[model samples]
Target chain A: MSEKIKFTIDGKECYAEPGQTILEAALDNGVYIPSLCYLKDVIPAGSCRICNVKVAGRFMTACTTPVAMGMEVENDIPELNELRVSIIEMLFVSGNHFCPACEKSGNCELQALAYKYTMMVPRYPYLFPEKKPDSGNKKLFIDRNRCILCKRCIRAVKDEQGRSLFAFKNRGNELAISLDHELAENISDELAEEAMEICPVGSILKKEKGFQQPIGHRKFDKQAIGSDIKSVIK
Target chain B: MSKPVVATTSLAGCFGCHMSLLDIDERILDLIELVEFNKSPIDDIKVFTKQCDIGLIEGGCCNSENVEVLRAFRKQCKILVSLGECAIMGGLPALRNGIPIKECIDEAYLNGPTVSENTEKILPNDDELPMLLDKVYPCHEVVKIDYYLPGCPPRADLIWNALIALVTGDEMELPYEVVKFD
Candidate 1:
C-alpha cells in the first residue's frame, strides 16, 4: 500500500489507494463505471474501451490505468460520452442484437448500458452479416449476430482457466469464436451456460432462458444481483 | 502456518471464473487460514505445481495449449473443478459455427473499416486461421471432469461450497437448478 491519490468522478472528490485502477476505486464507492469487458478478479483487458474517461486532458481506459497523486479525472465528459455511445453503436451493428427475441433482455448488461446512455436507434448501419442458423446444439447455441466479441470468454478459458478453449480464430471483426476442433461435437451445454453469464449482451445466452421471461418481469435491473438493496434513484 | 496449497487456472472460458473466485468480498481472507494462494495470476506464484489439493480452472479448450494445461492440472491436483461456461461448455467463442470462416474473416478485416492494414500480412493470416466447427462443444467432450460448477461464473456460493466439499470429501451433488441443462 502507498499514499492515497485524489481524483474527481462525476464531480465527486474521490480517494484511491496507490496502484488501484480508477474504475476499481470508483466501483468500491458505489460510483458506476460502465464496462462490459472489465469483469472484476479477471485480468481487466480494457477491450470494450467504454469506460474511457478524460484524465486532465487526454482520454484513457479507467480499468487499466493506475492511479497517481492528485490526478484529475473527468468521467462524464461529452467527448467520453460520445465515445461510449459510438462504442455501443458499433457493438450493436457488429452483431445480431435482436433484443426482442433474445434471452438476456432484462439482465443484459449491454442493454442496460445502452438504456443508461439513452441510445434508442443505432446510429451506425447494422453489419447484418448473414449468420448460420443457431447450431441447434440441443443444449446451447451461439447467435453470432448478437455477439460483440468482447473476448472475455476467450481470455477466461485461455489465461484464467489454463484451458485455451477459444482463440481469436481470425483477425479483426472477422474474428468469430470457434473451438479448436474443426468438428461440431466438441462443446457441451454446461459450458454454454458459463459463456452466457459473462456475455454482457444477448449474443451468448442460455437456450432455455431465451424468450422465457419477457424483459419486464426479469429482476435485478432495480437491484444488485441477489441483494435486497434497491436503486432508490431509479 | 499450514495454508492449504491452492491452484487456479482457466480452461476454455472468459476468465469470469477467476473473477468469481474473488467475488466473495473480503471474507475470503477468513479462508486464508486453511487455504494458501499458490499458482495464480493474482498473487505470488512460481512453478506450476502438480501437487495442489484444490485446482480451479476456467474456460474450455479450443486449442492444444488448453489441452496441455488441463492434463497438467488433472495429473497434479487431488480435486479439479471446472469454473465457468467456456470450461463447462465451449462458451460464446465457440459460436463461430453458424457462418463460413472465410465470410467471418472477410467481414472483419477485409471489408470492415476497423481492420488494420497489418492484419492482412501475417502468416497463417485470416485465411489460415482454424476453420470454424459446424457446431460448438463443451470440455467434458475432451476430458472426464471431476466436478462441474456451472455458471457463466457459477454463483459465488456454488464455488465456495465446492471448495468446502474438497476438504470434507463430500461429493458435491449439484441441485436441479444448477445442473439442469437447457
Candidate 2:
C-alpha cells in the first residue's frame, strides 16, 4: 500500500494520496468543501471559485490543487466564506435569476448557496443581459438567461460516441452554453434529466418537469448544500 | 412607542407578497396589536397620513409613478425594507430589461399576436398616465432600502420573523427551510 500524505485542513488532521486534489482528499476525510462545476468522474474544471481555500496565506481552488504533505489549508474561515458569498452574489446579479419564476428554485445549487450564505440581497448592480432560451429539444430546454457558464453539463454529459452534449458557444460578453444536436436524435430521458441535474442553475431544465416536489421536501430546503457530507462526518 | 408604525406598497408587482403577508394567518391579530398600518393596501390607505417606522415595499420600479411613490416611501419611512424578489432584483418584469424599450412597447402595443383591436396603434401617453421606464429597477437602485427579504414572495414565516424582530428588537432566526427564494 502507498504511504498516505498527511495534511491539515483548518487544523484538522487529514490524509491524502499523492495525486489527490484538496477537494477529493477532503471528501475522503469526511470534510465538505463546497463546489460547483466539479462533478464526480469528470475532469475538474476549477471554473467556479466556490471551492476556494486559503493555502500558505494565498488563495487556491480546492478542486484543482493537489494536496501537499504538511500543507496547512484554511477551508471554512469567515474571510474565505465572505469571498464565497460575494461570488454567489456576483452570479446572481450577472444573470436574470428570477428565483420566484424558476422551475428549479427550490433545488438549484446556486440558490441553495445563496441561502447558505444568508445573502439577503446582492450588493452588485444587476446586469440583466438579454439571452434566449432553446426549447426545440423534446425533453429539455436550455435557458441561457440563467446560465452562469460553469460548464458542468459540458464536462459531464456525453453521447455514446463520447461527445459532449453541451458546449460553450461565442466569445466574451456573449459566451453561452448550447446543447448539441444530441437532442435532435434519440436523446434518452435519463440524459435529459442528467443535463438538468448537472447544471448548478436552472439553465438546463427538463421541459414540463418543474416544481414537482413540494416546498419543504425540495433538496437543500431543510439543510444546507454540503450538510449531507457534514452530517456523515459528525 | 406608538406601535412601530408600518406602511407597505406594491409597485410593478402581482400583490403576491402582500398576500403572503396576510398568510401570516392568526398572527395577523398579534401583528396588528404590535404595529400600526399606514399608506398600505392592507388598510386601503391611499396616502401617508404620517411618517412610518417601517416600510415594506413590494416590486421594482417599472414606471415614473413607481419611482415617485418609492421616493415618497423613502422620505416618509425610517426603515425601508424590500419585501420580495421583485423589490430585490426586478423579478420577472425585468425580463424585458435586456430588450430595447421601443421593441418592448411596440411588441406590447403594435405587434403582439393578440393585439388585434388597435388598427390605429394608440399608445397611452396622457399626462395623467405614468411614463414607462427604460427598465425595471430594484428598490435599492432607486432609494436606500434598509433590508431585503427574498422569495417570489418571501416565505410567510420569514416575513413574520422579520417583523417580530423589528418590533421586539430581537435577533431574527433564519431557519434554512423558511429562507427560500421561491
Interface RMSD of each: 13.4, 1.0
lDDT of 2 by residue, B28-137 (tens): 99999999999999999999999999999999999999999999999999999999989999998988898889999899999999899989999877999999999999
Computed on C-alphas against the true complex, the DockQ of each candidate is 0.01, 0.83
TM-scores of chain A in all candidate models: 0.81, 0.96
Report lDDT (CA) for all predictions. 0.65, 0.90
Model 1 lDDT, full chain set: 0.65
What's model 2's TM-score?
0.96
Local lDDT at B172 for model 1:
64
Segments in model 1 whose C-alpha atoms lie over 4 Å from true places: A133-138, A157-161, A180-191, A219-234, B1-182
TM-score of each: 0.50, 0.96
Residue runs of model 2 more than 4 Å from their true location after superposition: A182-184, A231-234
